[model samples]
Target: MATPNKENAPQHGTTGTAPLLLSRVAGNASAPEILIATMHGKEAVLAPALALLGFQVLLPVDYDTDALGTFSGDIRRPGTAFEAALEKARRACDATGVPRAVASEGSYRPSQSLFPGARNVELLAFVDRESGVEFVEYLTDVPTRFVKGRVPADPAAPETRALLAEIGWPAIRAMVVPNDPGEGVVLPEQVFKGIDHEAALAEAFRVCATHSDDGLVHLETDLRAHMNPTRMASVALVGTRLIERLRQEGYASAHPQFA
Candidate 1:
Protein backbone atom coordinates (compact mmCIF):
# COMPACT_ATOMS: atom_id res chain seq x y z
CA MET A 1 0.00 0.00 0.00
CA ALA A 2 1.43 3.37 -0.98
CA THR A 3 1.22 6.09 1.61
CA PRO A 4 -0.44 9.36 0.61
CA ASN A 5 2.69 11.23 -0.42
CA LYS A 6 2.36 14.73 -1.89
CA GLU A 7 5.65 14.26 -3.73
CA ASN A 8 3.96 11.78 -6.08
CA ALA A 9 1.35 14.28 -7.29
CA PRO A 10 3.33 16.40 -9.76
CA GLN A 11 4.21 13.54 -12.09
CA HIS A 12 0.53 12.51 -12.01
CA GLY A 13 -0.36 15.99 -13.39
CA THR A 14 -1.71 17.52 -10.21
CA THR A 15 -0.57 20.73 -8.53
CA GLY A 16 1.13 20.52 -5.12
CA THR A 17 -1.20 23.16 -3.72
CA ALA A 18 -4.25 20.96 -4.42
CA PRO A 19 -5.47 19.24 -1.29
CA LEU A 20 -5.21 15.46 -0.96
CA LEU A 21 -8.21 14.19 -2.94
CA LEU A 22 -8.31 10.97 -1.02
CA SER A 23 -8.91 12.87 2.17
CA ARG A 24 -11.85 14.61 0.59
CA VAL A 25 -13.22 11.29 -0.69
CA ALA A 26 -12.88 9.75 2.76
CA GLY A 27 -14.97 12.52 4.29
CA ASN A 28 -17.69 12.46 1.63
CA ALA A 29 -20.71 10.14 2.06
CA SER A 30 -22.04 10.53 -1.46
CA ALA A 31 -19.17 8.43 -2.76
CA PRO A 32 -17.97 5.26 -1.08
CA GLU A 33 -19.16 2.03 -2.70
CA ILE A 34 -17.22 0.67 -5.70
CA LEU A 35 -17.58 -2.64 -7.50
CA ILE A 36 -14.61 -4.42 -9.06
CA ALA A 37 -15.08 -7.34 -11.48
CA THR A 38 -12.36 -10.00 -11.43
CA MET A 39 -12.73 -13.73 -11.06
CA HIS A 40 -9.29 -14.68 -9.72
CA GLY A 41 -8.34 -13.43 -6.28
CA LYS A 42 -6.77 -9.92 -6.40
CA GLU A 43 -8.35 -8.20 -3.42
CA ALA A 44 -4.95 -7.75 -1.85
CA VAL A 45 -3.58 -6.26 -5.04
CA LEU A 46 -6.47 -3.79 -5.44
CA ALA A 47 -7.64 -3.22 -1.88
CA PRO A 48 -4.78 -1.04 -0.69
CA ALA A 49 -5.35 1.69 -3.27
CA LEU A 50 -9.13 1.66 -2.81
CA ALA A 51 -8.59 1.87 0.93
CA LEU A 52 -6.51 5.00 0.48
CA LEU A 53 -9.32 6.43 -1.61
CA GLY A 54 -11.86 5.55 1.12
CA PHE A 55 -13.94 3.23 -1.05
CA GLN A 56 -15.94 0.25 0.17
CA VAL A 57 -15.15 -2.31 -2.48
CA LEU A 58 -17.67 -4.91 -3.66
CA LEU A 59 -17.05 -8.14 -5.56
CA PRO A 60 -19.52 -10.31 -7.42
CA VAL A 61 -20.33 -13.94 -6.53
CA ASP A 62 -19.78 -16.81 -8.98
CA TYR A 63 -19.37 -14.31 -11.81
CA ASP A 64 -18.82 -15.90 -15.20
CA THR A 65 -16.35 -13.29 -16.38
CA ASP A 66 -14.74 -15.86 -18.68
CA ALA A 67 -17.52 -15.11 -21.15
CA LEU A 68 -15.53 -12.00 -22.07
CA GLY A 69 -12.19 -13.72 -22.54
CA THR A 70 -9.61 -15.90 -20.80
CA PHE A 71 -5.86 -15.85 -20.40
CA SER A 72 -5.64 -19.46 -21.56
CA GLY A 73 -7.19 -18.62 -24.94
CA ASP A 74 -10.20 -20.80 -24.26
CA ILE A 75 -12.44 -17.76 -24.71
CA ARG A 76 -11.41 -15.23 -27.33
CA ARG A 77 -11.83 -11.65 -26.11
CA PRO A 78 -13.42 -9.44 -28.72
CA GLY A 79 -12.36 -5.82 -29.50
CA THR A 80 -9.69 -3.91 -27.56
CA ALA A 81 -8.74 -4.17 -23.90
CA PHE A 82 -10.34 -0.78 -23.30
CA GLU A 83 -13.70 -2.00 -24.59
CA ALA A 84 -13.59 -5.14 -22.47
CA ALA A 85 -12.62 -3.18 -19.35
CA LEU A 86 -15.48 -0.72 -19.79
CA GLU A 87 -17.98 -3.53 -20.19
CA LYS A 88 -16.60 -5.22 -17.10
CA ALA A 89 -17.01 -2.04 -15.07
CA ARG A 90 -20.58 -1.50 -16.21
CA ARG A 91 -21.66 -5.09 -15.69
CA ALA A 92 -19.99 -5.25 -12.31
CA CYS A 93 -21.75 -2.05 -11.28
CA ASP A 94 -25.09 -3.53 -12.30
CA ALA A 95 -24.41 -6.77 -10.47
CA THR A 96 -23.26 -5.13 -7.24
CA GLY A 97 -25.95 -2.47 -7.41
CA VAL A 98 -23.32 0.22 -7.03
CA PRO A 99 -23.31 3.48 -8.96
CA ARG A 100 -19.53 3.64 -9.01
CA ALA A 101 -17.39 0.76 -10.26
CA VAL A 102 -13.85 -0.18 -11.11
CA ALA A 103 -12.71 -2.97 -13.37
CA SER A 104 -9.48 -4.02 -15.08
CA GLU A 105 -8.50 -6.08 -18.08
CA GLY A 106 -5.05 -7.16 -19.22
CA SER A 107 -3.41 -8.97 -22.11
CA TYR A 108 0.06 -10.46 -22.72
CA ARG A 109 1.64 -10.54 -26.14
CA PRO A 110 4.70 -9.51 -28.12
CA SER A 111 4.91 -5.74 -28.40
CA GLN A 112 5.92 -3.60 -31.36
CA SER A 113 6.32 -0.47 -29.22
CA LEU A 114 8.45 -1.88 -26.43
CA PHE A 115 10.28 -4.94 -27.80
CA PRO A 116 9.71 -8.07 -29.80
CA GLY A 117 9.50 -9.95 -26.51
CA ALA A 118 6.32 -10.40 -24.48
CA ARG A 119 4.70 -7.32 -22.92
CA ASN A 120 1.83 -6.85 -20.48
CA VAL A 121 -0.86 -4.22 -21.09
CA GLU A 122 -3.06 -3.63 -18.04
CA LEU A 123 -5.97 -1.22 -18.04
CA LEU A 124 -8.27 -0.07 -15.26
CA ALA A 125 -11.60 1.71 -15.69
CA PHE A 126 -13.64 3.76 -13.25
CA VAL A 127 -17.26 4.63 -14.03
CA ASP A 128 -19.78 6.79 -12.28
CA ARG A 129 -23.11 5.58 -13.59
CA GLU A 130 -25.18 8.48 -12.24
CA SER A 131 -22.85 11.25 -13.32
CA GLY A 132 -21.93 9.48 -16.58
CA VAL A 133 -18.29 10.11 -15.82
CA GLU A 134 -15.72 7.50 -16.73
CA PHE A 135 -11.98 7.36 -16.27
CA VAL A 136 -9.78 4.72 -17.84
CA GLU A 137 -6.04 4.40 -17.29
CA TYR A 138 -3.50 1.96 -18.63
CA LEU A 139 0.17 0.96 -18.31
CA THR A 140 2.42 -1.31 -20.30
CA ASP A 141 5.45 -3.17 -19.01
CA VAL A 142 8.18 -4.58 -21.24
CA PRO A 143 9.64 -8.06 -20.83
CA THR A 144 6.80 -9.08 -18.50
CA ARG A 145 8.43 -12.47 -17.83
CA PHE A 146 5.70 -13.99 -20.01
CA VAL A 147 7.16 -17.04 -21.71
CA LYS A 148 5.88 -19.94 -23.80
CA GLY A 149 7.27 -22.94 -25.62
CA ARG A 150 6.47 -26.49 -26.53
CA VAL A 151 7.06 -29.25 -24.00
CA PRO A 152 9.17 -32.23 -25.07
CA ALA A 153 7.19 -35.39 -25.78
CA ASP A 154 9.32 -37.51 -23.51
CA PRO A 155 8.13 -36.70 -20.03
CA ALA A 156 11.20 -38.26 -18.40
CA ALA A 157 13.68 -36.35 -20.56
CA PRO A 158 16.04 -33.98 -18.72
CA GLU A 159 15.24 -31.22 -21.18
CA THR A 160 11.54 -31.55 -20.44
CA ARG A 161 12.14 -30.99 -16.71
CA ALA A 162 14.59 -28.22 -17.53
CA LEU A 163 11.95 -26.46 -19.59
CA LEU A 164 9.56 -26.55 -16.68
CA ALA A 165 12.28 -25.36 -14.31
CA GLU A 166 13.08 -22.45 -16.61
CA ILE A 167 9.45 -21.28 -16.31
CA GLY A 168 9.69 -21.32 -12.47
CA TRP A 169 7.88 -24.73 -12.50
CA PRO A 170 6.06 -25.62 -9.30
CA ALA A 171 6.83 -22.20 -7.81
CA ILE A 172 4.49 -20.63 -10.40
CA ARG A 173 1.43 -21.86 -12.28
CA ALA A 174 1.95 -23.40 -15.73
CA MET A 175 -0.78 -24.15 -18.29
CA VAL A 176 -0.62 -26.59 -21.18
CA VAL A 177 -2.59 -26.50 -24.42
CA PRO A 178 -2.44 -27.98 -27.86
CA ASN A 179 -0.50 -25.73 -30.24
CA ASP A 180 -3.77 -25.31 -32.17
CA PRO A 181 -6.22 -25.55 -29.36
CA GLY A 182 -9.84 -24.51 -29.85
CA GLU A 183 -12.30 -23.04 -27.40
CA GLY A 184 -14.07 -25.60 -25.16
CA VAL A 185 -11.22 -28.04 -25.90
CA VAL A 186 -9.28 -26.78 -22.88
CA LEU A 187 -10.69 -29.40 -20.58
CA PRO A 188 -8.66 -30.69 -17.64
CA GLU A 189 -8.04 -33.93 -19.59
CA GLN A 190 -6.27 -32.06 -22.34
CA VAL A 191 -5.38 -28.45 -21.51
CA PHE A 192 -4.00 -29.17 -17.98
CA LYS A 193 -4.23 -25.66 -16.58
CA GLY A 194 -2.90 -24.39 -13.25
CA ILE A 195 -0.18 -27.05 -12.97
CA ASP A 196 1.98 -26.21 -9.95
CA HIS A 197 3.50 -29.55 -8.94
CA GLU A 198 6.11 -31.84 -10.51
CA ALA A 199 3.69 -34.72 -10.97
CA ALA A 200 0.99 -32.47 -12.43
CA LEU A 201 3.54 -30.86 -14.74
CA ALA A 202 4.67 -34.24 -16.08
CA GLU A 203 1.10 -35.38 -16.51
CA ALA A 204 0.24 -32.16 -18.33
CA PHE A 205 3.04 -32.75 -20.83
CA ARG A 206 1.96 -36.34 -21.42
CA VAL A 207 -1.72 -35.48 -21.71
CA CYS A 208 -1.26 -32.54 -24.05
CA ALA A 209 1.28 -34.47 -26.14
CA THR A 210 -1.18 -37.23 -26.92
CA HIS A 211 -3.77 -34.63 -27.87
CA SER A 212 -1.33 -32.83 -30.19
CA ASP A 213 -0.74 -34.20 -33.64
CA ASP A 214 3.01 -33.49 -33.37
CA GLY A 215 3.28 -35.19 -29.98
CA LEU A 216 4.37 -31.91 -28.34
CA VAL A 217 2.68 -29.80 -25.65
CA HIS A 218 2.46 -26.03 -25.74
CA LEU A 219 3.63 -24.90 -22.33
CA GLU A 220 3.22 -21.34 -21.11
CA THR A 221 3.58 -19.43 -17.90
CA ASP A 222 0.06 -18.44 -16.82
CA LEU A 223 -0.27 -14.66 -17.15
CA ARG A 224 -3.37 -14.39 -14.98
CA ALA A 225 -2.85 -11.70 -12.36
CA HIS A 226 -3.49 -14.16 -9.52
CA MET A 227 -1.31 -16.86 -11.05
CA ASN A 228 1.66 -14.72 -12.09
CA PRO A 229 3.32 -12.34 -9.66
CA THR A 230 4.67 -10.25 -12.53
CA ARG A 231 1.17 -9.68 -13.85
CA MET A 232 -0.13 -8.99 -10.34
CA ALA A 233 2.48 -6.28 -9.89
CA SER A 234 1.44 -4.73 -13.17
CA VAL A 235 -2.18 -4.73 -12.05
CA ALA A 236 -1.25 -3.17 -8.71
CA LEU A 237 0.66 -0.44 -10.48
CA VAL A 238 -2.37 0.23 -12.67
CA GLY A 239 -4.46 0.48 -9.54
CA THR A 240 -2.16 3.27 -8.36
CA ARG A 241 -2.51 5.03 -11.71
CA LEU A 242 -6.32 4.80 -11.57
CA ILE A 243 -6.33 6.20 -8.05
CA GLU A 244 -4.20 9.09 -9.17
CA ARG A 245 -6.64 9.84 -11.96
CA LEU A 246 -9.55 9.77 -9.56
CA ARG A 247 -7.65 12.01 -7.17
CA GLN A 248 -6.92 14.51 -9.90
CA GLU A 249 -10.55 14.44 -10.96
CA GLY A 250 -11.61 15.02 -7.40
CA TYR A 251 -9.26 17.99 -7.09
CA ALA A 252 -10.73 19.53 -10.24
CA SER A 253 -14.25 19.34 -8.84
CA ALA A 254 -13.24 21.83 -6.15
CA HIS A 255 -13.26 24.61 -8.77
CA PRO A 256 -16.39 25.38 -10.79
CA GLN A 257 -14.41 26.13 -13.94
CA PHE A 258 -12.49 22.84 -13.85
CA ALA A 259 -15.58 20.92 -12.85
Candidate 2:
Protein backbone atom coordinates (compact mmCIF):
# COMPACT_ATOMS: atom_id res chain seq x y z
CA MET A 1 0.00 0.00 0.00
CA ALA A 2 1.05 3.62 -0.45
CA THR A 3 2.94 5.23 2.39
CA PRO A 4 0.63 7.05 4.79
CA ASN A 5 0.33 10.74 3.98
CA LYS A 6 1.74 12.37 7.09
CA GLU A 7 0.96 15.90 5.91
CA ASN A 8 -2.73 15.17 5.64
CA ALA A 9 -2.78 13.41 8.99
CA PRO A 10 -3.90 15.41 12.03
CA GLN A 11 -1.14 17.30 13.81
CA HIS A 12 -0.98 16.94 17.60
CA GLY A 13 2.25 18.49 18.88
CA THR A 14 2.15 21.74 20.79
CA THR A 15 4.95 24.23 21.54
CA GLY A 16 6.09 26.20 24.60
CA THR A 17 6.30 25.27 28.27
CA ALA A 18 2.84 26.48 29.12
CA PRO A 19 0.84 23.74 30.81
CA LEU A 20 -2.14 22.36 28.90
CA LEU A 21 -5.57 23.05 30.27
CA LEU A 22 -5.99 19.42 31.22
CA SER A 23 -3.02 19.70 33.60
CA ARG A 24 -5.10 22.02 35.74
CA VAL A 25 -8.11 19.73 35.84
CA ALA A 26 -6.94 18.17 39.12
CA GLY A 27 -5.58 21.48 40.34
CA ASN A 28 -2.01 20.17 40.04
CA ALA A 29 0.48 22.45 38.30
CA SER A 30 3.02 19.66 37.97
CA ALA A 31 0.68 17.08 36.57
CA PRO A 32 2.58 14.28 34.90
CA GLU A 33 2.53 14.37 31.11
CA ILE A 34 1.77 11.21 29.21
CA LEU A 35 2.32 10.91 25.49
CA ILE A 36 -0.49 9.23 23.50
CA ALA A 37 0.72 7.28 20.48
CA THR A 38 -2.08 7.77 17.98
CA MET A 39 -3.07 9.44 14.75
CA HIS A 40 -6.79 8.69 14.87
CA GLY A 41 -7.99 11.27 17.40
CA LYS A 42 -7.84 8.84 20.32
CA GLU A 43 -6.43 11.46 22.65
CA ALA A 44 -9.76 13.27 22.74
CA VAL A 45 -11.54 10.23 24.15
CA LEU A 46 -8.73 9.23 26.52
CA ALA A 47 -7.70 12.63 27.87
CA PRO A 48 -10.65 13.13 30.21
CA ALA A 49 -10.00 9.81 31.95
CA LEU A 50 -6.27 10.48 32.30
CA ALA A 51 -6.99 13.95 33.61
CA LEU A 52 -8.64 12.38 36.63
CA LEU A 53 -5.19 11.29 37.75
CA GLY A 54 -3.74 14.72 37.07
CA PHE A 55 -2.13 13.45 33.88
CA GLN A 56 -1.63 15.75 30.90
CA VAL A 57 -2.06 14.23 27.45
CA LEU A 58 0.56 14.76 24.76
CA LEU A 59 0.47 13.83 21.08
CA PRO A 60 3.42 13.55 18.72
CA VAL A 61 3.22 15.60 15.56
CA ASP A 62 2.85 13.76 12.26
CA TYR A 63 3.22 10.31 13.76
CA ASP A 64 1.72 7.47 11.67
CA THR A 65 0.45 4.63 13.84
CA ASP A 66 -0.86 2.76 10.78
CA ALA A 67 2.63 1.43 10.10
CA LEU A 68 2.10 -1.00 12.96
CA GLY A 69 -1.16 -2.24 11.40
CA THR A 70 -4.45 -1.26 9.91
CA PHE A 71 -7.93 -2.78 10.02
CA SER A 72 -8.10 -2.72 6.20
CA GLY A 73 -5.52 -5.54 5.93
CA ASP A 74 -3.09 -3.59 3.78
CA ILE A 75 -0.45 -3.55 6.51
CA ARG A 76 -0.70 -6.70 8.62
CA ARG A 77 -0.32 -6.06 12.32
CA PRO A 78 2.60 -7.69 14.10
CA GLY A 79 2.20 -9.83 17.24
CA THR A 80 -0.73 -9.81 19.68
CA ALA A 81 -2.81 -6.70 20.39
CA PHE A 82 -1.10 -6.14 23.72
CA GLU A 83 2.32 -6.44 22.15
CA ALA A 84 1.49 -3.98 19.40
CA ALA A 85 0.16 -1.49 21.94
CA LEU A 86 3.25 -1.81 24.07
CA GLU A 87 5.50 -1.29 21.08
CA LYS A 88 3.62 1.80 20.08
CA ALA A 89 3.86 3.21 23.58
CA ARG A 90 7.57 2.59 23.59
CA ARG A 91 8.01 4.08 20.13
CA ALA A 92 6.21 7.23 21.18
CA CYS A 93 8.51 7.67 24.14
CA ASP A 94 11.59 7.00 22.04
CA ALA A 95 10.58 9.40 19.28
CA THR A 96 9.57 12.35 21.44
CA GLY A 97 11.88 11.82 24.40
CA VAL A 98 8.81 11.45 26.58
CA PRO A 99 9.34 9.20 29.58
CA ARG A 100 5.71 8.06 29.83
CA ALA A 101 3.35 7.03 27.02
CA VAL A 102 0.15 5.21 26.18
CA ALA A 103 -1.07 3.44 23.05
CA SER A 104 -4.01 1.33 21.88
CA GLU A 105 -4.69 -1.45 19.41
CA GLY A 106 -7.98 -2.86 18.14
CA SER A 107 -8.96 -6.04 16.36
CA TYR A 108 -12.20 -7.48 14.95
CA ARG A 109 -13.22 -11.02 14.17
CA PRO A 110 -16.24 -13.26 13.54
CA SER A 111 -18.15 -13.87 16.75
CA GLN A 112 -18.14 -17.48 17.95
CA SER A 113 -21.35 -16.92 19.89
CA LEU A 114 -24.86 -18.00 18.95
CA PHE A 115 -25.33 -14.72 17.15
CA PRO A 116 -23.62 -14.51 13.77
CA GLY A 117 -21.63 -11.28 13.61
CA ALA A 118 -18.28 -9.74 14.49
CA ARG A 119 -16.71 -8.64 17.75
CA ASN A 120 -14.17 -5.92 18.50
CA VAL A 121 -11.33 -6.35 20.97
CA GLU A 122 -9.44 -3.28 22.13
CA LEU A 123 -6.25 -3.05 24.18
CA LEU A 124 -4.47 -0.13 25.78
CA ALA A 125 -0.90 -0.09 27.09
CA PHE A 126 0.90 2.36 29.34
CA VAL A 127 4.65 2.52 29.79
CA ASP A 128 6.60 4.36 32.46
CA ARG A 129 10.29 4.69 31.63
CA GLU A 130 11.72 5.55 35.05
CA SER A 131 10.05 2.64 36.86
CA GLY A 132 10.45 0.30 33.88
CA VAL A 133 6.85 -0.80 34.23
CA GLU A 134 4.19 -1.43 31.63
CA PHE A 135 0.48 -1.84 32.27
CA VAL A 136 -2.07 -3.21 29.81
CA GLU A 137 -5.85 -2.89 29.87
CA TYR A 138 -8.19 -4.55 27.46
CA LEU A 139 -11.85 -5.21 26.61
CA THR A 140 -13.31 -8.11 24.64
CA ASP A 141 -16.61 -8.57 22.78
CA VAL A 142 -16.97 -4.82 22.66
CA PRO A 143 -19.87 -3.48 20.60
CA THR A 144 -18.96 -2.57 17.03
CA ARG A 145 -20.51 -1.50 13.75
CA PHE A 146 -18.22 -3.81 11.79
CA VAL A 147 -19.67 -5.35 8.62
CA LYS A 148 -18.27 -6.90 5.45
CA GLY A 149 -19.64 -8.18 2.15
CA ARG A 150 -18.56 -9.16 -1.32
CA VAL A 151 -20.33 -7.43 -4.19
CA PRO A 152 -20.04 -6.99 -7.92
CA ALA A 153 -18.53 -3.92 -9.54
CA ASP A 154 -21.88 -2.36 -10.25
CA PRO A 155 -22.74 0.08 -7.47
CA ALA A 156 -26.28 0.52 -8.77
CA ALA A 157 -27.07 -3.13 -8.12
CA PRO A 158 -29.75 -3.95 -5.53
CA GLU A 159 -27.36 -5.98 -3.38
CA THR A 160 -24.87 -3.13 -3.34
CA ARG A 161 -27.60 -0.69 -2.35
CA ALA A 162 -28.72 -2.98 0.45
CA LEU A 163 -25.20 -3.31 1.82
CA LEU A 164 -24.74 0.43 1.73
CA ALA A 165 -27.99 0.95 3.57
CA GLU A 166 -27.08 -1.65 6.15
CA ILE A 167 -23.75 0.04 6.88
CA GLY A 168 -25.38 3.47 7.04
CA TRP A 169 -22.99 4.82 4.42
CA PRO A 170 -22.14 8.54 4.31
CA ALA A 171 -22.45 8.48 8.08
CA ILE A 172 -20.40 5.54 9.28
CA ARG A 173 -17.83 5.49 6.42
CA ALA A 174 -16.65 2.42 4.48
CA MET A 175 -13.58 0.77 2.95
CA VAL A 176 -13.26 -1.17 -0.30
CA VAL A 177 -10.76 -3.77 -1.49
CA PRO A 178 -10.53 -6.46 -4.11
CA ASN A 179 -12.53 -9.57 -3.28
CA ASP A 180 -9.52 -11.69 -4.31
CA PRO A 181 -6.16 -9.99 -3.83
CA GLY A 182 -4.25 -12.88 -5.42
CA GLU A 183 -1.02 -14.33 -3.99
CA GLY A 184 0.89 -11.10 -4.20
CA VAL A 185 0.52 -8.18 -1.78
CA VAL A 186 -2.38 -5.80 -2.34
CA LEU A 187 -1.15 -2.49 -3.68
CA PRO A 188 -2.22 0.99 -2.67
CA GLU A 189 -4.25 1.42 -5.84
CA GLN A 190 -6.37 -1.60 -5.02
CA VAL A 191 -7.56 -0.34 -1.62
CA PHE A 192 -9.97 2.49 -0.95
CA LYS A 193 -10.64 3.73 2.57
CA GLY A 194 -12.65 6.41 4.37
CA ILE A 195 -15.28 6.35 1.63
CA ASP A 196 -18.39 8.24 2.78
CA HIS A 197 -20.22 9.42 -0.34
CA GLU A 198 -22.11 7.43 -2.96
CA ALA A 199 -19.95 8.69 -5.81
CA ALA A 200 -16.71 7.84 -4.04
CA LEU A 201 -18.02 4.44 -3.07
CA ALA A 202 -19.01 3.77 -6.64
CA GLU A 203 -15.61 4.81 -7.90
CA ALA A 204 -13.80 2.72 -5.32
CA PHE A 205 -15.94 -0.30 -6.18
CA ARG A 206 -15.06 0.13 -9.81
CA VAL A 207 -11.31 0.38 -9.24
CA CYS A 208 -11.05 -2.36 -6.66
CA ALA A 209 -13.27 -4.69 -8.69
CA THR A 210 -11.01 -4.22 -11.70
CA HIS A 211 -8.09 -5.69 -9.76
CA SER A 212 -9.99 -8.62 -8.30
CA ASP A 213 -9.73 -11.99 -10.01
CA ASP A 214 -13.43 -12.55 -9.32
CA GLY A 215 -14.39 -9.10 -10.60
CA LEU A 216 -15.83 -8.32 -7.15
CA VAL A 217 -15.07 -5.90 -4.36
CA HIS A 218 -14.94 -6.35 -0.59
CA LEU A 219 -16.69 -3.61 1.34
CA GLU A 220 -16.61 -3.11 5.08
CA THR A 221 -16.92 -0.52 7.83
CA ASP A 222 -13.90 1.71 8.47
CA LEU A 223 -13.00 0.82 12.06
CA ARG A 224 -10.50 3.63 12.67
CA ALA A 225 -11.30 5.52 15.86
CA HIS A 226 -11.81 8.78 13.91
CA MET A 227 -13.97 7.20 11.25
CA ASN A 228 -16.04 4.85 13.37
CA PRO A 229 -18.03 6.39 16.24
CA THR A 230 -18.96 3.01 17.71
CA ARG A 231 -15.32 1.98 18.04
CA MET A 232 -14.43 5.39 19.48
CA ALA A 233 -17.03 4.95 22.24
CA SER A 234 -15.56 1.57 23.10
CA VAL A 235 -12.09 3.08 23.32
CA ALA A 236 -13.41 5.69 25.71
CA LEU A 237 -15.03 2.97 27.80
CA VAL A 238 -11.80 1.00 28.04
CA GLY A 239 -9.80 4.14 28.75
CA THR A 240 -12.09 4.93 31.65
CA ARG A 241 -11.59 1.44 32.99
CA LEU A 242 -7.81 1.79 32.70
CA ILE A 243 -7.91 5.02 34.65
CA GLU A 244 -10.04 3.39 37.36
CA ARG A 245 -7.58 0.53 37.62
CA LEU A 246 -4.69 2.89 38.07
CA ARG A 247 -6.65 4.77 40.72
CA GLN A 248 -7.42 1.56 42.61
CA GLU A 249 -3.72 0.78 42.57
CA GLY A 250 -3.07 4.07 44.34
CA TYR A 251 -1.40 5.74 41.40
CA ALA A 252 -2.76 9.10 42.49
CA SER A 253 -1.10 8.71 45.85
CA ALA A 254 2.17 7.76 44.13
CA HIS A 255 2.45 4.39 45.78
CA PRO A 256 6.05 3.21 46.21
CA GLN A 257 5.54 0.41 43.72
CA PHE A 258 4.61 2.80 40.94
CA ALA A 259 6.65 5.74 42.20
Candidate 1: regions farther than 4 A off: 1-31, 111-118, 180-189, 251-259
Q: Rate the local accuracy (lDDT) of all candidates.
A: 0.65, 0.72
Candidate 1 matches the true fold with a TM-score of 0.76
- In the range 139-172, model 2's lDDT, one tens digit per residue, is 8878768788888788888888888888878688
lDDT per residue (tens digit) for residues 176-257 in model 1: 8877443244554465777787677777776777777688778888777677777777778888888788878772334342
lDDT of 2 at 239: 90
- Measured by TM-score, the strongest candidate is 2
Local error of candidate 2 at residue 11 (angstroms): 13
